[model samples]
Target: MWDKQVMKPVSEPANSPSYVQVRLKLLRDIATGVWPLGGRMTLSDLEARYGVSQSPVREALLRLEGDGVVVLHPHRGAVVPQVDAALLTQVYDIIGALQGMLARRAVDHLTRTHLRELEAHLARFDAALDGGDIVGAVAANGAFHGMLNSLGGNPQAKALIETRFALAQATRRLVGYSSGRTAEVKQQHQSLLAALILGDGEAAAQVLVAHADTARDDLIARLLSKGAASTAS
Candidate 1:
């Protein structure tokens, strides 16, 4: 049975930019695990499901491919890229390195305005957690990290981090950490933002590393528990 909570609404973005709307819907589905890892995604299926023309779906798939969320298989069509434990570890390590560098650099450049924006994001996250809004929590989490990367000022690094973050989203969702650890995750974000505000690169990096480590541990434990339960059943 498909979990309804996993079936996120595919709402059109404001202004309803045709191509972007299609792309956003597809990305949302992938992020929410509606399109599970290694699952095939057919153009025809997307076109029928999204009620969009083939062109937009194709473009979206191409974009997702570039982001490492989808792989173009010669004989198999587009499939959600699988991240094994080794690969997941590698990706998170890279994420920690890139984000550490970015945050360190950003501390020197983080403006008062930027800090205010980050604080607002944190507030939103807190509100979402208090209200038990999982979807809102996810969105705020993305916004907070996105703002951090954007403020870091290296477009190339930012692009890579964005891709890695998307991959992490899939992993996080699969392990049920995306919403379940909201309070702990929000606190980590607050700590990182504080380090950034104080222009403490070392502190910021340490916080981020800890944050990533916590996520990795949670994911591993969750997957192991699921496997054990499945075997017993």
Candidate 2:
């Protein structure tokens, strides 16, 4: 079920030329299951829901299709696809490796200011998790990674990482976490932060890989369990 609070309009950027704001809102909503698995919705419905115009709605949906979150049909509107474990495995594997590369390269370039920014984001993550706000935690987690990925100064890498991050956001909503699971994630972030502060790129990369692996395994378990329950019922 979609949280009503999440459906509210996201704060927008003042100078964004493109409809990136609309895209993000749509991505977050879909990722968080404002529209459930395999659910169908037309552009008009999305326009009304997000208070965006037709073109931006269309653009957002097309971008989501590229990310493997939603599919478009000629006469069937847009539908969220069934979760594919194998595909997600491949995506996570590539993401983990690329993320490791980004972190490894970022070590030499990261400044004290960058480290402080990361610490701030990590603090946000901790507070969000403590409050049991999954959406906020996810946003903060993404920001933490975004800061690190930015330190590498690789635009292409950042773009790829953000895309994969969007896809992963979808999974987080599907595979909702227990408090213990959330705690584990928080610990992983702490470990990554410690490694970064020590200038241990290898250790940071290793933590990033392990973090992705843990997420992959947990999400697969949850999706499989959900499928089984649906089948049995």
Candidate 3:
């Protein structure tokens, strides 16, 4: 059971402006897999945890329900939505398409300042990978991509990409089971950044596609390995 008063905000700023503070907290929990797939969530539980009134908690739950992150039930309150393979594929596919477009646009418009920021983000990603901070690495990866997509100057496309990226984050925890792949992922990011810096949209798009495909392959392999272990047992 969650106590609203005792609940500490995790991701949002201390002075978060949104009335949906509870919603933001819940979203973070779900995104990070702290809530886990199909885990039960309740309005009362959230209210107690964040020390907020039921209004905000309820509103947050409704928003999450709309976002497809949570499913509301008549008797069961809300539960984290499951991430099936089909949904995962769709999310990745959309991400790949949008990112491909973004990369193409970015190559022509990418400024020196943008490259510098990307390089700095890459350095942080490298450090996170070296330290085996999977979460940090994931965040840095998103930041780098978000920056690239924002530079594309298409708000509608960027909005869609952002949603797809969030879905990817939700599914990424499963793939992140392999720590050995961290360096390779980082190297891929470096390659993509280099391509972008050189104003080669085609190369950057290819690299991005390859990177996403590799991640999907790695995740499938992990799933197979788990199944094999289960059968052996």
Candidate 4:
């Protein structure tokens, strides 16, 4: 049984592969700050942590490594990247451009169904933020973009966006989320949706790019603040 401090664990989908289940759980743990950046988890420790065997754990780490979230040592363990300013800037830069690309393409293919789905995601985001559920809000926010990205119908671009998810999660977990940004996020989403509805791909892309830049800037500020605080302490 998970300890009391732990939130209820995410249940794996039925018949999922063992390694995939391990990977999801591992990602969740890392994203939630169970391990600090640059922390090492040896093969045995990971096997124990997730209550799985070595085979699946190794495979899972390989996948995360490929996604640029972890580094593997020969015959040893994995380490979460000790992210720096340059790395953060580079990752968010790529993420922003890809999201803008997808948002623009998303406009050309919108249907009533897709719009409704996007609205539902927005509602979920508002509710989460209202309740001060930062984790929930973040999850909903990801779902919102993920749905919009899908509507773009470019699997390659969508796949590239996903590869950055773990690294993005790490930055958010480290710097923390801001309710202060709520209004801006909501407005951006609303404006992007309106642009998509109006079939203005360029407008939607611009809004998305701006939205991404705003997010990146906020995280950078928070990250610097945390470092300063730690030094003072």
Candidate 5:
């Protein structure tokens, strides 16, 4: 049994790969900024904290290191990588371009059913945000984009986007939303859907790029503000 304060139980089936599940939970926690950036954790600490054995915890940290989410220093152990302004700009730019490219191609393959599914995700996202369920909202937003990206019919492109998705998630905690920004997100979703419905690929692509750009700007601003505050204090 998991100690509630230290670990959350994984809901995966008993037959599933336990290590994968453990790794996923760790990834989610890190992505949501539950682990402080640049904070070090020893293998024993991770094992105890995640309620997993040494093997899985080690494997998870290794995998996270490969993904650039964490760095395994020889003497210091595993540390969550700090968010840097230049790195954020580059990653978000790539993400924005990928989103635009995917949206452009996806228009040709998307059907009415896909649009309906996206609409459902949008509703779920909006509801989660309104209820102040940040985790739920982030999950819903991811599902929405996952569905949209899947429609592109380019496996290679989709695969590349998935990598960037991981990078984006690591910094997701910084992208805090105001009420006005929440409304803006909803409007942007509607606009993208409208363009897609009309078979206006160019318009849809532009909307996708613009949406990513706005998110990038907001995140960078927040990070800067936080850095300044810490420096002042």
Candidate 6:
């Protein structure tokens, strides 16, 4: 169901190691469902996929395992657990609450420089949406949040939020988007931007949580449709 893939790389230090880069590439694939639920990813598959040697692949898997994104089996490869709709909903609920809190905190520290960066990402989102480019919109939306989440300055919370992103991306792949939803998302982005500019932490938090809530509904609706289609087929 990962029909579209959009990887927008953040700036990495020149000294960033190969293992880290491999890990990120692997994680991006996993997020977009290149690795299916319950699927096994052998070390050989990874090495071949990334054109990397054994050590970097092993280390990358280790990092993902630590993040709960994969589970390693001795002499076997890492396995992606099937994250069901119910569990995904719970994950989103937690994400919504945590990100809402992060949005609230971000207000105290958001500066003009940060706002300008955010505005750029937001403009990208609007452009993508206007052009009916969902994949581009998804990437732009992520860049916007990546910028916003950084504003919280809470690494612990940020890490927690990030671990669950792949599942959400998987949901996006399956659901795609209904007509008019992009407009709603654009409105929410506008509202959130306005709230942050006004230093209205509560308003910003509310909009973010609402955004997550919409995602939850989208996942449910799409999966149900998939089920119905399967039944008919």
What lDDT does each candidate get? 0.72, 0.76, 0.71, 0.78, 0.74, 0.79
- How far residue 130's Cα lies from its native spot in candidate 3, in Å, is 2.5
Runs of candidate 4 exceeding 4 Å displacement: 1-29, 34-36, 48-53, 178-180
Best by lDDT: 6
Number of the top-ranking candidate, with TM-score as the measure: 6
For model 2, the run of ten residues with the poorest summed lDDT: 1-10
The TM-scores, one per candidate, come to 0.74, 0.77, 0.74, 0.80, 0.74, 0.81
lDDT of 3 by residue, 99-145 (tens): 88878987766667778988888888788868867677767877788
Between candidates 1 and 5, the lDDT winner? 5
lDDT of 5 by residue, 39-140 (tens): 777777777777878777777777767766678876556888777777777767877788788788778766677789889999999999899877777778
- Answer with 1 or 4, whichever has the higher lDDT: 4
The deviation in Å at residue 171 for candidate 5 is: 3.1
If both were scored by TM-score, which would come out higher, candidate 2 or candidate 3? 2
Better of 1 and 6 by TM-score: 6
94-156: candidate 2 lDDT, tens digit per residue: 779888988898787766777888999999988987887878877888778877876765667
Give the clash total for candidate 5: 0
Model 2: CA > 4 A from native: 1-21, 49-53, 178-180, 230-233
Candidate rank order under TM-score = 6, 4, 2, 3, 5, 1
Better of 5 and 6 by lDDT: 6
Ranked by lDDT, top first: 6, 4, 2, 5, 1, 3
